[model samples]
Target: MKPKNIGIQMTDKALLFINGVPPENLPDTINYSLIACSDGAFHYLKEKGFPLEKLDFISGDFDSHSGKDETIYHEKFIFTPDQNKTDFEKSLEIIKERGYKEVDVYGGSGGEMDHFLGNLTVAFIFKDDLKITFFDDHSHYFFAPNILVLNDVKNKLISLYPFPKAENITTKGLKWSLIKENLEITNRIGTRNFAQENSVTIEFDTGNLVVFIGN
Candidate 1:
């Protein structure tokens, strides 16, 4: 059976930049969904008047949720008291169980250091089964091994971070080419790279490479 194209939006304990309302193009409809990770995120969504009814379900321990917001969306919320996993991980597990091949995460990186790092690490935990992308107000970050083709990323900032030690890496259409360069995580080898054209290609011979692109 083919995997479902599930879009997972997470509301971590983060500060959102509500710049006069988010664009309508922001995804309001999700085929399978999870919510109530953080009370702050829930409040922001409510303030923006996002469609809460479209969510498949909301799962979270009520530690972060105040009684006020709980009353607002009680019918559609699933209160889970599990303290073992983070809300972000819980949401990913739910999506994976539903057989989603790709998961897009928003509002994951703006909160406390532990939450931000926890959310980022969640990508690796589910990398084999799902393509997870973390998005913030300014950047989109994901890890890809083997070959990655980025189209029309001109004038954008792209950085690569190698994990578990770097291996032979090469780049095409980038300002700097790796050409079998070994980039260790301790060394800031893959930072501040630019795209020379509308498209860019990167290939990693070994190890996981995290690619971050933003303004």
Candidate 2:
């Protein structure tokens, strides 16, 4: 199913988010028109000396704000009081609602294990609809279960992790190819694989998977 008002989903550009522990590639000027930061990340950037003026929105629960807050957005920040969804997830929803086709996520790693894993899960949650990629210090993580055709990634190290079950999977342009394998949450894991060609392809009959390609 498509998101509501699919017509509004314009612009192929990526919107950057400051989440967990951002990669060093993050620049002083993100170059994007608008940027988003989670509630706690707002404070994180404030303490770290990020130009707060560049911040367009500070999402998540308002509880993260502390003494002598900088942005008046906190007075009217996009506060999501729900505790069920992670703050990152809340940010993703707002991005999608704004009609962005892709979101470049950073800061979901190099910290708490739960935060890292939870951040990874956000990819799976919106895999079918949004083109979301998580960036760590090392690799770019893809959390989609679609027709995989990656270019200029040959000879790069790649790994796959299944959510619950990914069936009848086939691969090409990989150092090790799977003819028709079952990559499940249980045994028969898929990781530490490498791409063998400039354009690698992966096709699966069913289920979602996380694809992590080394930078």
For lDDT, the strongest prediction is 2
Alpha-carbon lDDT of model 2:
0.74
> What lDDT score goes with residue 49 in model 1?
75
Q: Candidate 2: how large is its RMSD?
A: 5.2
What are the candidates' C-alpha RMSDs?
A: 6.1, 5.2
What is the TM-score of each predicted model, taking all chains together? 0.78, 0.83
What tens digits encode model 2's per-residue C-alpha lDDT throughout 127-208?
Answer: 7668887777788887655578888998789898887778888899999899888898778778999998999898888887
* Number of clashes recorded per candidate: 0, 2
Q: Which clashing pairs does model 1 show?
A: none
The whole-model C-alpha lDDT of candidate 1 against the native structure comes to 0.65
Each prediction's whole-model lDDT (CA)? 0.65, 0.74
